[model samples]
Target: MKTLYVQVDINSYNGKLYDFKTDIADLQKGDVVVVDTINGMLIGKVVGYTDDTKATKWVIDKVDTTAHKARLERDKQLAALRKKLEARRKAVDELTAFRHLASMDSEAAALLTQYEALIQ
Candidate 1:
């Protein structure tokens, strides 16, 4: 199977980015990506290609079988953690709505803080 590395630059605050070899004819622009945010392994679509030096830069860290496995595992864990976080956020929203109905501003504000913490 053809694999691509999900890449990002520290300067860009965008969610995630990807880089792949252009030699693969099947890969096209605007493909959706499933990326390993840390291990540099993931699935992502081809957003576009650049002739810029960044695209051709040699990868300092070589990807190995073990690293690939670790990246997959880490992606799975992050997915689970995100689900839990969303649930907590929903709870916070519900509590805030209830507090609003009861005219409890202080409680609503506190719940908002809790919600932010859960997201972070």
Candidate 2:
């Protein structure tokens, strides 16, 4: 199958930003891309693809299936970690509410805050 691979740089807070290469064929929308992020590789579903001819020059690399699978596994692990973090946040919220309703125990509040901060 003839596939198009485009290079993209994703910032921590900002999202996927394309660094278009002049030599490569302009990528189309719905193209699958393997983005190399800070933590690891990620398979990003293309939301936007452009044919702007004035982009900067760069090299495009071919992505194999093995690399793609590894990216998928990494994504799964990241998702699980996010879920755990969210659960911890919810627990902290519950504890804070409980503290407000019942006791004004400073120790329990401090402990929950410490735990919540640690997860992040």
Candidate 3:
């Protein structure tokens, strides 16, 4: 019998490739599977099959549809939060630049400083 070695790529890990042994014959590309790594159990996508015979880890199980949906939602939320923060940072920089244009002792400069501190 030929041992199946599946190449897995974890989303968070990006381009890294991890190989694990499995008996599940129905697994296909893009299928999410739980892998047994030295650190612990991790979820990864099956990118392809590997021909290497030496294997020390096993693919525990495929991730269910419910879990996959939850992960996708979590990723979406994280991306939205990152975009919001980026916009806020750009606004803050513009505000700071606008404030710096005023004279050092002017009342407008003082007010702007107070407003900037409040926003920050």
Candidate 4:
């Protein structure tokens, strides 16, 4: 009847400590291990432990180097895609606004003109 608190190095959780059960006698803080999660197998680091005896049912395992590497690569690709999309959206917004600037009222046109100058 042992309870463990683990900090998983996953993107979504960002190294948050989740509850788990530890069977090994020597498990301690700062130990890197793999865990079975609802999402699949994930790598985690043991940050704390307790004898509260409430079983969380999560199992620790040996590191899955393949899954770890693949997850990192996927995160990198996703980040790049998000950056590109943000840039595209900004450019589209600027272009569309600039195109209609001439048809705006005096105050709106003046504000847009000042904004365009600042952005440039």
Candidate 5:
């Protein structure tokens, strides 16, 4: 895998470095590349390279309007899935805390069990 340093021009942030790795050879600095991000398909300019972080990189040469739109849609779907997962995780944590509290005190245990039944 070849490492490439990219500069992304975003509205809220300026000149943030997004390091990407690619199997496609001959990528040079200042080359406009399409990168898949959690936000969307970001148009990034290759600045340089780095020896930091190792992961599978998904890098594309160019992104047209159609591809960009598809990327955005996919990202939206992923965000929704992540939100649902986080909610489930929060519920599990709350239940675990309640169970721990119930184990500590007998008086509160009855009240906590009732509350848990209502939520479920």
Candidate 6:
């Protein structure tokens, strides 16, 4: 019977360190591995090796990290978009105040002064 072995030390989110032995000959140090957890399968980085901790479960797989990369990229784009939207909102409000001021509305200047103060 073949049993699972984990040899690499992993960085887990919960700050737990584990030692496992694997039959995967090419499973080297510094690889990203998928391991089974109580919550779900999580990705961990193989930072080093150790003989200290015991492993009772298997490293499910070694993933390519395409999904992770894509998620990071999407988040970056989303942040940029949100920042642009906020800037545009401010600009639109300022333009509306200018229009009111052009019509000689009395409170428009006060509104613009308040906006400038808030921004500073």
TM per prediction: 0.34, 0.33, 0.52, 0.40, 0.45, 0.53
Residues 1-120, model 1: lDDT tens digits: 333332433223355554434334343455443333454544444555554444542223322357777999999999999999999999888867766754657776776677667867
**Candidate 3 C-alpha error for residue 106, in Å:** 54
lDDT of 2 by residue, 23-72 (tens): 33545554555554444655543445455545543333324458878999
- Candidate RMSDs in Å, in order, are 15.2, 13.7, 9.5, 10.0, 14.8, 6.3
lDDT per residue, candidate 3, 39-91, as tens digits? Answer: 89999999989997687899999877887699999999999999999999999
The ten-residue window of minimal lDDT in model 2 covers 55-64
Predicted structure with the largest lDDT when compared to the true one: 3
Error of 3 at 32 (Å): 0.4
Across 19-42, the per-residue lDDT of candidate 5 in tens digits comes to 666655666666667876777766
| Worst lDDT 10-window in candidate 3 | 96-105
As a whole number from 0 to 100, the lDDT of residue 7 in candidate 6 is 53
Q: lDDT per residue, candidate 6, 1-120, as tens digits?
A: 344456544455565666554545556667888777665767776655555446766677776778899999999999999999999999988778686784586677777677667867
Model 2: residues >4 Å from true position, as ranges?
A: 1-63, 103-120
In Å, residue 68's CA in model 6 sits off its true spot by 2.2
Alpha-carbon shift of residue 33 in model 1 (angstroms): 25
Model 1 ranges with Cα > 4 A deviation? 1-63, 104-120
Error of 3 at 91 (Å): 34
Q: What ordering of candidates by TM-score runs from best to worst?
A: 6, 3, 5, 4, 1, 2
lDDT of 4 by residue, 90-111 (tens): 9988878775865666777777
